[model samples]
Target: MEQTNQIERKLKLMHVVAIGLAYMSPMAVFDTFGIASDISSGHVPAAYIVVFVAILFTALSYGKLVRQFPSAGSVYTYTRNVINPYLGVIVGWVTFIAYIALPMINALLADIYLSAGFPEVPGWLWVVGLIAIITFLNIFGVKIAASVNMLLVIFQALVGVIFAYLTIRSIVKGPESFIPIGDIFPSGGEVPELFGAAALLALSFIGFDAITTLSEDTINPKKTIPKAILLVAGIGGVFFFTVTYFMQSLFPDVSIFKDIEGASPEIAVIIGGNLFLSFFLSGALFSVFASGLAAQLSASRLLYAMGRDGVLPKRFFGYLHPKFNSPVANILLIGVLSTSAIFLSLEAATSLINVGAFTAFSFVNLCVIISFFKHKGPRSFGFTVSSLLFPLIGLAFVVYLWISLDIFSIIAGLIWALLGTIYLAFTTNFFKKEPPQIAFDELEA
Candidate 1:
């Protein structure tokens, strides 16, 4: 069956709004603050400020790319245009893997969050349920997907902003316990170490790119693409920086950090948690649910594009569901892989997430610089400084984070990327692979 291409321009714009905000919603606050605590001691808030600045530079790079080439498949899409198609497929495949890992980790995290209330229910139970809900929304259609995501993002942002406002109010009210702003630069611990720790948490800054993958469904493709990304990062950077500080101020206790008793770093509960933290924890599943929903949408589009381009089997994945106008087969394929990966690495999902993100970020940061250089096509001077210089620094920081990943986490990234290379070779040969699909048809013609 032929794909309808019915995703109207408006829905595409709305998709951008939904995906951009959803990625940075309430769950992200948990993510940022949680990671910050692990690396910065009680000064978790200060760590966010560092990551905020780093990703903010990278966001500028993304903004330039989206303005020039607005299409699905994001990083791979951009890289394919300037470099070899085969190379594009490798980047695309690796990113697809990273995208898949996102949902698995999020769903697993949701399970843990839900465990606080229904101690009897296994976390994977929540994982399964989340998979079903988001998959269905994805299958239903983009209009419904966008609407649901928009509502979810709005709800998440509202609740989070409220939490932020309250945390800020709490800070102003009295001498609540917290790592003061002055404490951001360590008194004795290595500055490089503190920066390294903060870099690891830069994983939270990743959602800014989530907007890029949905380019196939965005409105005013060139205009909205750049604006949405910058907007999300701007909001996310400020939001993360502000909330981490306030959470520390609201409850200055290191009391929450003891005996997490597992692989996952229990960041939030350690920093500013009590019974009230349960409220956020309870609501957290929805945030994770939101992340899975957004990631699935992005990944499936990627999978579909791969099939359409002959890098993957077209017979199975090339066809779209008649009713859903979506790639039901590819969506299910990614969902299953993601679910299996969660259990396969249940012991290591969290660490691997940070590690995989670093790998992808390093690849992307480097890709941007490479793409910037390879572009003989017309590009503004301002674009050069923004995309090139910024990504170089971002790439350096990503490498710094890559080394800091625990031995096990580094092993996981190496193995995953290695496996992806193998899959790319076999699949490319099997499908009689050709060039990467340009996000813009005009670029090729």
Candidate 2:
């Protein structure tokens, strides 16, 4: 086995951009081409406008939060400062689950893609292989991970662009033919149901906030974090809408929801573009690879910070590797939990993940709104309030999306909150005799 060196805090701005890029890839193309197709019914691409606008408000809030704290614990640290301490712990726990669930889904999809090539090899092997590779890179530290992510983001971007451009450019000869600019619209339906369907499918476009989770580790966190987020949303939005529209144009017969093998409507764009199955599968694999790396990197840092705050078991959560300077214990814990989740219920996992991520994103946004009001020093923050409750309106927008999530997701989120509460109570009871607990980093030094 190779011994890893401790990682120095030498990661620069472009590396931070790599983090945003790779982190955005996991579900970016998948949802854009897959999930977006489902609700779009030709109108789904338009919903990108709504999702992008909503994300702008959310990004504004996160930008403010990261500027305040240039340390780890992106959501947890922000929520802790803006809200109650207990709420912070709950937010951390749930976000951990969210982080884990995303990679699990991606890994599963990756394995499925692998299984196609190697019938002799089990799908689980590739999944575990990906985990081990990412874990090793992360333990080596962020800079190396960021370097790998740069290559990955490039690959995903190229594959996606090529797939889209080919489909669009070749539309003249492909089956069903590409719809011109005028074809993007709803045929006929209730306004409420149409919008709701758009919203339901729009959940796929939620990776920009996840990209913001790396805010704590960035150079000039405020400027870098906001730019990375806005970049992800802007680029992701335009790209997603373009491919989805072209795919719809290429396949006039297939409904977005209809499931079929490759060369069908689900994959009509690739099929029409004459892309080999190899490219499609490779792209999916790359998507999940980026997903796993980003999740493990961000989530490990989350645990490291939470432990430092004395919110969890310090021995497990707070222990940093002397040799690697990575949160070894926390990384192992997250890996085990995520691996265990491979066989668990995806519906439950997805719902829980979505709600947890949604809440954190909402809170991060809400905190920004509060921070601006609280510390509006001259030119303090953006946006002038025309109404008495401009802040309230922003807060309400976040909360409404937070509630619109599935009940299963809410229950899962609440369960994690309760667990955090229970653990806090136990720790308080056990440490009753101690005057004060030492910090994790203090123990390390």
Candidate 3:
């Protein structure tokens, strides 16, 4: 019988980190390995190292901004408060589309994998069933969703561990010695290939930033959220580099795989035969489940933040269930939206993701630089590097990745941005007024 407008703060640091890891999907290293190895000329881990640097600097920017204005809006909240309110709405709108698209990608992947395994079952059935289970858990409670993600993430780590054991054992039993140091670094004329692989690998780190959207649901968000962001990025990076380092050492080239595009399944067969391949594929399916759960949770929290700020409809988007104290309305809306996966191609859904992700990454870094100059902090070496230099480097790195995107992604992103601009114009009466600001202090209180 009790109703509340606020989302409850119940998640601790570990829970938040778990959801973030699920969102990143550590098993993804296998999915990306074949192509990245080919591009890096047999140095996937080095490419991971290249992308991790960019991710580390950006994680620092996220940490700095979350300390100043910790809210469920993530990059959207940061931009609105630190930069301009109107700009924040546009950023939020663009990122909203991005978050919404993520669940669809997971759903599509699930459908493909499941349908491949169960030939008689329809693909659309898999998509709908996957979304339904994820939405049910999310609406049950954020804590429940986080717990599920933790278990799923643990399972993924187990699979990675087993795979690594088999790979290392195989290499030891073979003729080639483990070239630990040499293979991870590129030789002359391979820098371009390494960067190219890094650009592709950058998308894998999207979930670390998504953790910021859980601020309202997190205890001591200003401290917990920032630390959780760094932990998620750092942990995921280490897991990725460790897995690929061994894989690169074992194969040393993409020519070994039958199908480079779908090499992970084959790699499992080669390493441990059919028995381990089943476990690997099951791990991949569970990963899709984990990712969809976290994605919907983040997307709903974002909508709730914007709704509370009057950037979207207040009644529906901002509403929390009286019993569960979760964002029921927004969660269901995303659940409904996820059904679009049945109609969308995986490539199309995948392309839409990078545009929104890169935009948020680039802007969050820029927001840090803007905040540094706007709010005069103590003139010290630590503050200068943390506030300005780190973000500048992060910005440059994101710009490089942004330009590396293919022409289709660029055009799709522009079209999405244009739609957001049109909606913003209508909301603000053609730029006569600024968008409403979120009451961060009151929310924390």
Candidates in order have lDDT scores of 0.67, 0.64, 0.90
- After superposition on all CA atoms, what RMSD does each candidate show versus the true structure? 3.9, 4.6, 1.2
Candidate 2 to truth, TM: 0.84
Q: In model 1, which regions exceed 4 Å deviation?
A: 1-14, 31-35, 168-174, 177-190, 252-278, 345-347, 375-384, 427-433, 436-439, 442-445
After superposition of all CA atoms, the RMSD between model 3 and the true structure is 1.2
Backbone clash pairs for candidate 1 read 12-217, 12-218, 13-219, 177-252, 178-252, 256-270
Where model 3 places Cα greater than 4 Å from the true spot, the runs are 1-3
Off by over 4 Å in 2: 1-8, 26-35, 174-190, 201-205, 211-213, 256-275, 372-383, 386-400, 429-445
1-445 per-residue lDDT for model 3 (tens digits): 5446678899999999999999998888999999998998988898999899988999999998888887889999988887888888888888887798899999999988998899899889999999999999999999999999999999999999999999999899987567668656888799999999999999889899999999889999988988999999999899999999888888887887889879999999988999999999999999999999999999999999988888898888878898889989999999999899888888888888888898899889989999888875576888888889999999999999888888988999888889988988998999898888766777672
* Candidate with the greatest TM-score versus the true structure: 3
Overall local distance difference test of candidate 1: 0.67
Full candidate order by lDDT, most accurate first: 3, 1, 2
lDDT comparison, 1 vs 2, better candidate: 1
**lDDT string, candidate 2, 132-173, tens digits:** 888888888677788888788788777777677667666766
RMSD of 2: 4.6
TM-score list, all predictions: 0.85, 0.84, 0.98
Query: What is the C-alpha lDDT profile of model 1 across 1-445, one tens digit per residue?
Result: 5665333334555567677667554465554454455556556666667777777766766776776666666777666665567767777766666677777877777776678678997667777887888888888776677787787777666657667765666666666655555765666755665686576567776677877776666666777777777777777767666766777666445456453222112433333356546555645666777778888888887777677666678767655777767778877887777776446555476665675466556666776788777778878877777678888988877777776778887676668777767887776674476654644664221
Output candidate 1 Cα RMSD: 3.9
